[model samples]
Target: MYKINDFSRLSETQAAYSAGNTNLLLYDLPQHYSDEYRSYDSPRLCTIINGAKEISVNQSEHFVYKKDKFVLLPPNSTVHMYLPEHTKALVYEFGDQLIDNVRQRVSDKLNIDISKNDSHETFMQDTLTQRIDALNRRIQEIVLENDVNMSFLIDLTCQEMVYELLKIKGSYDIIYHHQ
Candidate 1:
């Protein structure tokens, strides 16, 4: 059971760069940097920018590298990650608000009721990695430029990332399904 403070501690120690709002965390871990068991308090998207890493979740091990660059961790999922030398990744921690808003918009657009199902499950989709990578690059550029609307751009990019995930086949089912 990980709390917010645990995330804070881990971020402080592992994060190479972290956003002031705490929504984005960038980690550049050395080879064989073993991240012991840890869980998140909220849903998060982990994207590998370079190198390779292994993540164990629910007794399953996943190797996320260049070809397969992203994994989504559901809230409260205990995970162990092993990063190879010079592994770099971006962690996007987000609440349900953005998802909910997107769901609402999607539902409204399709004229369907999405609230009938609500399940909290993590999803791993490699296909969406490229888009996320592009978004990350754009965000990084915007941040580097010190854009006055950095906050807004970040928020929009975050939403776009979630939207892209939701667009994947079966992703919406995983997220909106109820037990």
Candidate 2:
């Protein structure tokens, strides 16, 4: 209900896949520069690339907005993210163990005997910026038009965008660790 996203997010893909269980979502939040809020049900991930965002968790706030910024929102998280004027950000709903998904793909793609070394969280994000923006724009176009066509388009577009993001992060194959 907040002005957190400029686009409409509709997707048929599961943002997280755990033992085959998938969480379905195609959410596009409005632009927000608000105070602390909470997600007592679902977990969220903020991948901020352009705009300025101030987020609060358990009543504590943190500012993040840059090509290198990303945050993990734990389930039932009493958190809020604030997006400043003229700001842009990307948010992902994550639950279960989506890191498995990233780790699997990264291992296969890079052919490295690599584990999530703490540096992998923000891997290749700059490479995915264009794709992320494109997806955001696509959703925005549909939302602004108030087009019923958004239903189908949003589903595909969001999935593609999310997929691209997973690819850049190396999917479930490369991001998770046992520790």
Candidate 3:
């Protein structure tokens, strides 16, 4: 298992930012890089800004093109990913606590139960790619601005993303199962 929290704690070289409860990772690869199958303890939303990648989840392989695709990896799911040269990507890592908090907030707002589903899958949604792209740009802008309440803005943006994802049909089940 690839524990993101452990990686965050142990690695001083990897440039990562913390906003509220979210961890942001910007990966810029110059050459071929392959990541072996590993399970993430938290959920991840990845957007490919440039280049292409091959991702394998549960023996299903997917080719993700740049600027037109986004992947959502559920917690505790194993995945293999390969990035070709000149690949740039933004990955947002959401802690379990953050997800729980969001779930509660959404559930309370909508008056519904947001419980976990049995399905642990990786979703590639092209329809959400544009929104993800816009969100990524906004995040970069806020990070560069370095405002006093940067964390708050980032957290709010992340919450917006979660709500948007929930609006999508199939993607809803990725985070919660309706009761």
Model number with the top TM-score: 3
TM-score, each model?
0.74, 0.47, 0.76
- Tens digits of per-residue lDDT for model 1, 1-179: 01121234554446323333237666666777776544356566776667877777655756555525667766666677776556766677765676778777776555443444344545554645578778878866766787777777777888777777776655565444421
Question: Worst lDDT window (10 residues) for model 1?
Answer: 1-10
Error of 3 at 37 (Å): 5.8
lDDT of each: 0.61, 0.45, 0.64
Worst 10 residues of 3 by lDDT: 1-10
Order of candidate numbers by lDDT, starting with the best: 3, 1, 2
In lDDT terms, which candidate is top? 3
- In candidate 1 the C-alpha lDDT for residue 152 amounts to 76
Tens-digit lDDT track of model 2 for 87-132: 5554555434444444454547655444445532222213236767
Q: What C-alpha lDDT does candidate 3 achieve relative to the native structure? A: 0.64
Is candidate 2 or 3 superior in lDDT?
A: 3
Model 3: how far is 113 from its true place, Å?
9.8
Which parts of model 3 have CA positions greater than 4 angstroms off?
1-14, 37-39, 107-117, 177-179
TM-score of 3: 0.76
